[model samples]
Target chain A: MEENSKLSQFQPVKSIFEINREERMAPGHRACAGCGPMIAVRQILQSLDVKPVVISATGCVEVTTSTYPDSAWLVPWAHVAFENSAAVASGVEAAMHALKVRGELKEERPVIALAGDGGTFDIGLQALSGALERGHRMLYVCYDNEAYMNTGIQRSSATPFGAWTTTSPVGKEWPGKAEIKKDIMGIVVAHGTPYAATASISHWKDLMTKVRKAVSQNGPTFLHVYAPCNRGWRFEPKDTVEVAKRAVETRFFPLYEVENGRYRITVPVAKPRPLEDFLSLQGRFSHLLKPENLEVLKELKSIVEERWSKINAAASVQVQT
Target chain B: MAQFEPVQTRKSLLTGDEAVAHAVRQSSVDLVAAYPITPQTIIVERIADFAASGAFTGQFVPVESEHSAMSACIGGALAGARAFTATASQGLALMHEMLYAASGLRLPISMAIANRALNSPLNIHNDHTDVMGSIDSGWIQLFVENAEEAYDRVIQSFRIAEAVNLPVAINLDGFTLTHSTEPVEMLSDEVVRGFVGRPPKRDSLMDEAPKSFGLMSLPDSYQFFKDDQSRATTGSSVTISQVEGEYAKLSGREHGPLKIFRPGSKVMMVMLGSYAGTARTTARRMKNDGEQVGVISLGWLRPFPEKQFLDALEGVETLMIMDRSVSYGAPAGPLASDVMSLLYRYGIKRKVIAVTYGLGGRGFLEEDAMRLFRYAGKSGSSFESFFFYGGE
Candidate 1:
């Protein structure tokens, strides 16, 4: 949900052929079970329509796809290192612009990247900040699953409160490791990006729709989409998207967009479900079923409700203006 | 009638910076991602003026920081354009992270790191630490001793970098060579046109066709990626000589790895950059005394002229390394350490003396250079004038 884009009411494309289908992320990649990110990535490539230069940081998507001579990618790619994806992308854009101006360029292309939670939240944040400040025409997709799932299930800054990963496992004295997830979406919006959105595999159409919005516009755009990891969550493989849908329905992971300085929830909460509906499916939250812990969990759900209300109220005020 | 040589010559007097810019300008370099740092600033400033005035047809991107400067240059190079930039001292250090990225990908990116000392409290002076720190990044490093060479080497860099299909750096001492403008006789436009032609590759990425650059490499394939880069860089020495030779043929002035200013002398001072002139003057003085002193100026620093250096120092008992910057906590200067490290491999364990001198942009006078020759120790000494500055 990109509030600014919602407010503008996106205009229709000029041509059907240019329906945004640059297959920078070619099909047939080997990701894990319940990996919502690969779906999100596939939809993004479908929307671009033009070939895009991709600079990927280290993490699951990169490791799984780039396995030597047999890459899941059909595009010509160079993988530098984790902390430098943003830096490397900046170089590609600069090089492309130079070549085009001198008539040395044979084609015109869009440059973007797919960065994971570890890459975006930890190692590559500084480079990302620099890229935004420089105003490169790039779209960065942060596929965040709230934890470091690739490396034996560890806690990350994006991991939610009261979640149980290897580092945040449940214990007799405490109800799993505790701490709230950082407001990464807010940070991107604060950077004053032209387009910023939070989407989830829960709303596939909305997630793919925002990807189109981001690439068409100039300057830097960031999309932080929620991904569910079944291995880490101890859930059945098939319930991945359904779990995500439940999280959104319960308003735990709200689907929304933030653009320029406005905010808008892309998929309105027509029927906000109970938080327990979203929690019961995953084993990570099984411990919360205990009486006292359940009460504490209810308090957390109420906090999410209260936060979404304020955001909705803000959007309504903007609509009034 | 004598046979007439129809020569295509571009002969004009220019500052070292202008000469270098003219070479690149002729190369039709499409992008320049450089910051305004001392010594090197002149090269970029002149380029900025040229780009702004439409004297050259290219994009002059004013990056926010040195990190972005190098970052942007890498992008442009990867996109398949002849990309270039310039920096000095702290600016070079700031770009340290991007250096590995550029070389690791084997992008034909070119940068001029005006040799300057890195800072703690802050000192803006000439030193090799900035470039020396980047020695292992796998860039082809070329050192120029004066304004004329600065112009010449930058021109040759594009050829060497593109030839090796790797990034290249042309290092010149700050202020000494950069700020101090001398009459640089640029080759004719025809000569430059004949020298640096267009790039072979087109824009590597386009909207119609996407490509992945700087992608993630796993442990399984990391060694091969680096090995490929090594092969590309090591293969550059041959192209470097070829390009330098062509440029020399066109301009009638020769320069390359271990280019001998005066060959076959009993005692020779080996060095690079502005101080080389001072050494030559002292060699002239020492030669008059029948001591057989001479000077050997090495233009290429990274793919060092080991064979030639060994040959130059063969008969000489004392090989002096005139280091302008110290390596700090090391036994000798960075260049000396490199020389010593290779001495056993090259089998030239001659008495190579180390001398650290002329830091923070201090002047390295002829008198100071003469003192090293007076010692007859064959080992180089630091320029001692920095200690006795501001005297009555």
Candidate 2:
């Protein structure tokens, strides 16, 4: 009678419980301590319940997850050449479609491509654009760490202005990066894809939401996640999340999503903090602190404001439509 | 022993490119990703027509570049689909990086290369430069002499590649064979499909196996993996011969790694691709003129075919190797270099001469083969200087 009563007590809990909870990106990976891209990758992968075939470019994520004879990915993954991840994903998607048509495959699988900023914004832009224009059913995620972190912190087009990268070092004739960051989100939107979004590692809930939304779409979808680099940005390893938070609070990286050619800013900062609060913590922008380089800081701030205003105008038009 | 008789096949007149298209259609290729390049464009064009007409049940991806084409093939193959593509000289060069990735991942993708000259003076003509340049890219290369061989090898390539778990490249001379129409004994779709069978059920990314491919390898493990790949390629000779034998049983046309004519001759010429046809005709004429001459055409460029080459060259006093592409600063051209290496390894010393000709679509005729063979047969002639035919 006591054993029956105990079994009756456990029945209610079992009714409310869900089984088979597993993490797709496993632990024991080679990512550094407090790696922001690793955090973004984890959160984004967790957003998908279905197993995805991951195609990665040659970057920190690929190098860390897949070392020779060992793999950290629990899901199926492939790392092709650096500049052809999207193209490879396009092929995989086509193959899946063909298999389904031929009745060789029964279950549908999502294809996800993970690339670094150097791959997405610079070298792999053409391939990515081709995939997007062709309407491949896949999701491409760019973990934007600002610079080429895998190749030792070289400057990429995604690197912001007034930042010191290996190739954009402060010298007598030059002051850090002379050009502003390339508007990669705008370029992706111009492809007229079904979905495109920008998220940051600090906003885990918002990033995962965007990931789920992107995956739900049928056509090509892109999500650009702002990932802070602790080593490359010259910050304490423990302050990785703190750095990423500051980047969002300062309006340096905005949170927005574009669905079906309509824009919506998800995280709108009512009062953005000064950009200096984010820059002063990272040694990459220490040169901008000099009084002689005050103009560069002003230029950076103006570019940020100009971008925010343009996004706001676009969102308003979308709302009106 | 009974003499082998050719099978009665359904004959059709087709170009090399058309033959390749027919083979792709006949084989159960699930996907084709390709970019249009000169001399190889007709292949994809015909494939597109077939796809549009609902004759071919596959996905034809018109990629933006050859790099993407090969990249897509890698993806499709990783997804456990039979993938195929075709390209020419510049297109092949553009796909150089992905070529290693395909072979390294063991994708078993088949590519048809319409062999053309590489650029610098931008010529779209027949040469071995494209395929020769990629000899070290870890693909099993088969050079065809005509449309019939091109069709047969394309079907045979899929079987060999999937059996050995490697990529195969079927190379035919650009304008010479790709544009010229010839009578080809084509196999029926059912026969070809039965011969190719289904793709081997390997662990692919599309399956539920959750496997990871193309991982980064450190110095400690990189060499071992590369050595394993080398072993797979070197050990594929038996698989190639077996598949060719099986294909012959179905098609009644025998295609071997090496084709020898007039064996055990005093003077012999070795060549690859369509030039072999002209060389064979020249050698037969020389034999009729009471001159002991012969020709050996190499169908398999990779795996070197050392034993077959040695067996064909036995008792030959002099060898004239016809190369359409130069090795540039080496003692001989690419084919001759491998032949010379084999001779040195086996301690067989023979008078060897390399005649590089037909580059940039310059014609290589029967007269040229006769001249080279006669030059090789004459005594007291130094083989020090490599002969460059039809050049200023």
Candidate 3:
């Protein structure tokens, strides 16, 4: 993990502009300056060769980008309620199938549902599970920002352990959030889908590659991308990418994919960094650094290490098979 | 508008559920996403059977929940496909959030709501509570009196909904009409195809030109979007009547926003849905016995045909408003509230008696209607008129 994190820092920044010149997602939207999800969405859209019909759940992306009458999407997009994007995408895919069968639609168009962690891991889990289990030919992209930032930084199931949020504040006998983040990628993988992967905005190339690969697949696909929020995390806007990179280095958000029940770790970290390296950068975990809260840090590190071991074990078993 | 002569049709005895399925088959629907719910289950079951038998070529998606059903319908509609779904009380309530999403996006998805009473102790019988609860959902609502009207309205709903780009809810009395078999003269597939025609391809997600749908609106622009929705819903009145006129020519039956049994009468009873049929029968018997009683049945509820309702009530001495749904703690039921508001707005002063009846599928009889009309006719101002019938 230490080696990969160092290598990422020294590696030259690839010009995404030269790779794909067309901006399917237009500029001048309502996304906050230095918003991590916005950058991830642009890169993901750029990776798609076909113009996708984007179904967005009610969250930061939907509210910021398409604010009634004026929309930032240059591609065909829709924003339904908060927790039914996947279900809506299933409908769109069914319609496309019907239209294609009737010879009304000529070209193949991919249906993509974009949601936040609050929509994906929490409220929308049932709909997402149904869509994946039904094997709809669609891609569901969840921008896991750790908390519900759009709703004033409330703690969702995606909020990391010991992270402070509005609902899980750090004060009065409580250090921060008492629970670990929900394992949403594991749940998606369990559905036996054709493609399911985890990506982060800090690693744009990896994210774009996985997006392209997922979109090319035939059945249901899910891509959970790590997105850091500046306001919610109490970080400087410029440190969004840096915070996201540290998260991967510390094994907080591992980059991996489960394709056809086979596990593969995309960005392997040889020596994992300490969890403090990632948590110290954000004020959400500032309370954990106090002298009395050392046990909380230890607990968080142990959890991360345990998760890393599980992923590695799964990869080794896949290799043997 | 060009007119086609009424073509010979086949008569079939079917329940309201089967009638809806037949109408869906004839309308050339592109997709259906639905969840099974009581009183509304047979509708989807029949549609699924039609799909299995190769009678209907559309895609049938049996979703997990009513929320997903509406969500899927909205998705299909956004992709430029004619989509539909059906549900009853709880299922409709589960779909309450998506209901707003469908209309706010203006997806023109048609839904059949088997009107059943909501649960306190859990009742799966007939009432208007389900549809009445969604009065402000921005969808055009049509109440059918029987299986034949249910069949015809479902077909006309597609044209009205698609032409106006608004979701339409066709309400049929659960169990009363949904389970009771009745003879309906069905239009041929060719005539329905010509009547409904092909839904014009709109600027949708499938189109080459990229468009955004169901966008979020901030406070600065949210009200304007609502205003646009209001205009679309209200503006659909003309298209509704025109489509009904066209449908009347094809089916040899006329339907509209409201149906007035006796135009000019001293005493009138106003209601909606299948209960109007019983009221009409009682009114005929009363008229024969020298009492001037008439029935005005409301078809459209969301647009709330104020002009037509007021015109029908003109010169009537007393108006009795019948509602199947209660507005707890309020002075009257939902229908009575709207009726009184309309009467108050028009500066018309007359004795208006509001009564709530047939809740949770309790049978509403013609005797109850006659008794209520008689009591309202003779009672002075001190009468306790606001009450629920057949309730403890």
Give each model a TM-score. Answer: 0.86, 0.95, 0.94
lDDT of each: 0.73, 0.87, 0.86
lDDT of 3 at A275: 81
Point out where model 3 deviates above 4 Å. A1-18, B1-9, B382-384, B388-392
Per-residue lDDT over B133-198 for candidate 3, one digit per residue giving the tens place of the 0 to 100 score:
888999999999989999999999899888998999999999889999999999898888888877
Could you tally the backbone clashes for each prediction? 41, 0, 3
Q: Which scores higher on lDDT, 1 or 3?
A: 3
Candidate 1 lDDT tens digits, A213-320: 787666788999888888887789899899889988988888888777788888898788988888899898887777868765866677788868877886788888
Task: Tell me the docking grade of candidate 2.
Answer: medium
Provide the lowest-lDDT 10-residue window in model 1 chain A: A1-10
Better candidate number, 1 or 2, judged by DockQ: 2
Question: Per-residue CA lDDT of candidate 3, range A1-321, in tens?
Answer: 011121112222246653456888777897887799998999888876568889999999988988667899988998888999999999999898877777788865877899999999999999999899888888899998889999899999999889999999987778789999888888998889988999999998888878777777778899999999999999999999999999899898889999898989999998878888998899999988988889998898888988888998998898997
Query: How does candidate 2 fare on TM-score?
Result: 0.95
DockQ of each: 0.36, 0.69, 0.69
Quickly count the clashes in candidate 2: 0
lDDT by residue (B166-270, candidate 2, tens digit) is 999999999789999999988877888898987878888877779999999999999998899999999999999999898889888877888998998888888
Interface RMSD values for all candidates: 3.2, 0.8, 0.9
Highest TM-score scorer:
2
